[model samples]
Target: MDGLRLENEIEGEKTILMLKERRPIRHIVNIPKTRNTFCKGTKCRKHTPHKVTQYKAGKASLFAQGKRRYDRKQSGYGGQTKPVFHKKAKTTKKIVLRLECTVCKYKMQLPLKRCKHFELGGDKKTKGAALVF
Candidate 1:
């Protein structure tokens, strides 16, 4: 049987298999005209508007979901959260510099120096956040 595949972008990289959940046929939806995609023609070197060539429908693993027993949780395994504890509680990760995304307008903290692809440019702020030296 054909299973759906899910992919997402994480930290400027594509992340696959974020989560798996089963759903009926209607849940699997595809954007129309996605099959035939064309690049956003632009003369700019890297500023070109991106284009979609193909669309992959995300899916959940049936084998993995079926193995889970929701009914048994009420007896001895029942709990509000999976793992029965805060085994998966999200923790704040340490970062170098904190800034807001210009595109998303969301507060984001990132390492000061690591990846070479990114150039450590000056802040968009004029006075406060902007570094003096």
Candidate 2:
């Protein structure tokens, strides 16, 4: 089949337009909406019902050793004391799941592969459903 084309007449000149070919779009990652995996807590050694949540880094403490040292170094009259990080290569961050044992109230972190988007307890996708870009 022929691709898309357009014909236009402006003033006294005839113009023809051709649309550029589009590249195939990549699909987003799909994960189960809910999971009931094994719990490795001291109270519950067997598989039990656990709450799933995304893992996020906590705020850095001002009283930390590295932060205190960096702040001390920057307080002087000298110019920039330490080198700032600017070389970031990866586009997506690794997904981490924070699993908490409902029985023993124990929490653990589970690291997964890198993904652009992450959803916890989201809607379940069916096979026949069309995907939205």
Best by lDDT: 2
Using Cα atoms with residue i matched to residue i, what is each candidate's TM-score against the true structure?
A: 0.18, 0.72
The runs of at least 3 residues in candidate 2 whose Cα sits more than 4 Å from the true structure, single-residue gaps closed, are: 1-27, 30-34, 130-133
- Backbone atom clashes (below 3 Å) for every candidate: 4, 0
What tens-digit string does per-residue lDDT give for candidate 2 at 35-128? 5778778778888777778888899999999999999999969989989899998677778888888888888888877766776766778899
Point to the candidate with the largest TM-score.
2
For all the candidates, what are their Cα RMSDs to the real structure?
21.3, 11.7
Task: Give per-residue CA lDDT, model 1, range 1-133, as digits (tens).
Answer: 3556788898899977645555332322222211222222343222222222222235965456543554444447535544555577433322244333233333323343222132233223445565567
The lowest-lDDT stretch of 10 consecutive residues in candidate 2 is: 24-33
User: What's the C-alpha lDDT at position 24 in model 2?
Assistant: 38
